[model samples]
Target: MTKINVETLTYTQLAKVFDHAILKPEQTTKDVEQGCKLAIKYDAKSVCVKPCDVKQAADILKGSSVLVGTVISFPHGNSPTTAKVAEALQAVEDGAIELDVVINIGHLKSGLYDECQKELEAIIKTCKAKRSDVIFKIIFENAYLSKDEIVQACKIAEAAGAEFVKTSTGFASSGATYDDIELMRASVSDHIQVKASGGIKSLDQVITFLQKGATRCGSSSTDKILEEFKQKNSA
Candidate 1:
């Protein structure tokens, strides 16, 4: 659970909870650069970029407090375990310190728990082998999942040694909801954090999620959200 009180949250405290997103397929090099700048400007925890942009994002964020994060298997999670490992290793080698990996949604929906667990384990083990400090987050893309599936996914994420279990890929039909945050937070142990991603906009939303026990959020609206916070708090 988040130890910070939302009512008394400071700007820097709130800023650290965001993983500024630059993962849109249509985004270009310019977008990644701009995103990194925004993250640095706001002192965000990290810039969650597409796998291809990890190197550039890392270069831009170097020497800054902001970390480089990338997605694996992306919005879709149909990649084979080996392929996921390869993709993750490349991103890590490119200086990504955080990896948000999509689970095999189809496999989970089909009740193939073992397959999902194995894949997650393989990716985590392979990446950690390279960088023991690399943070691993498992993305459930929760919009497509049932409540039971979400709970099960949380358990599997913990079992697979994930540091966080995220709500969505931000490419889904729906994003993080209050109920999902509550459910996920309850579903996982304290060692595993809950990250509410997708459709999270505004200062109120960020505060609400953090209050509900989420440690992080993935958002493309980093500027808007932080600007709103700044304006409100300065008043």
Candidate 2:
């Protein structure tokens, strides 16, 4: 959990909790560039770009504190394990410092636990072998999962060596809800932090998630959120 207190949170500290979302499929090169500039301007923790945008985002964030990140297997994680690893290898080579991957929810729900665990292990082992410092987050896409399923997923994530367990892909039927965030936090061990994603738009929403034990958020509204943080903290 982050040590930042709500009452004393600064815009800078708030910025560090954000993985500025640049994941829209419609985003052009110019859009990614603008997003990268925004991350740099706010000193955001990272620019969570599309896989194809990793190189560009990395170049833009080069020499800055902001990390360059991209999604693996993306909103739907139906790809074969080998395919995901190959995609991740290229993204890391393109300079991604972090990778958020969607687990094979179908496999998990189908009770194919061994297959799911093997896939996660392969992906994590492959990525870490190449980039030891890279932060790997597993997205549970919690909208489709029951509370017990969420806990099982978190356990799988920890056993497979993930650094964080995330909720939602935003492309889902619903986004990050407070109850889901709290439940995820309560279920995971301290070694595995929680990230609340999908539809996290405002400062109050971000703060609410943080108070519930999320360490980071993925958002397209980085500017609006931080500006509000600045104002509220100063007020």
The lDDT for every candidate, in the order shown, is 0.92, 0.89
lDDT of 2 by residue, 1-235 (tens): 4454658686777889999998889999999999999999999999899999998998888899999999999898899999999999999999997899999999888878778778989988988899899888999899899888888888888888889999988899998888888888888787789999999888888988888899899999999988877777778
Off by over 4 Å in 1: 1-6
Q: Which stretches of candidate 2 lie over 4 Å from their true place?
A: 1-6
- The prediction achieving the highest TM-score against the true structure is 1
Evaluate model 1: give its TM-score.
0.97
Estimate the lDDT of model 2: 0.89
Predicted structure 1: clash tally: 0
Model 2, TM vs. native: 0.96
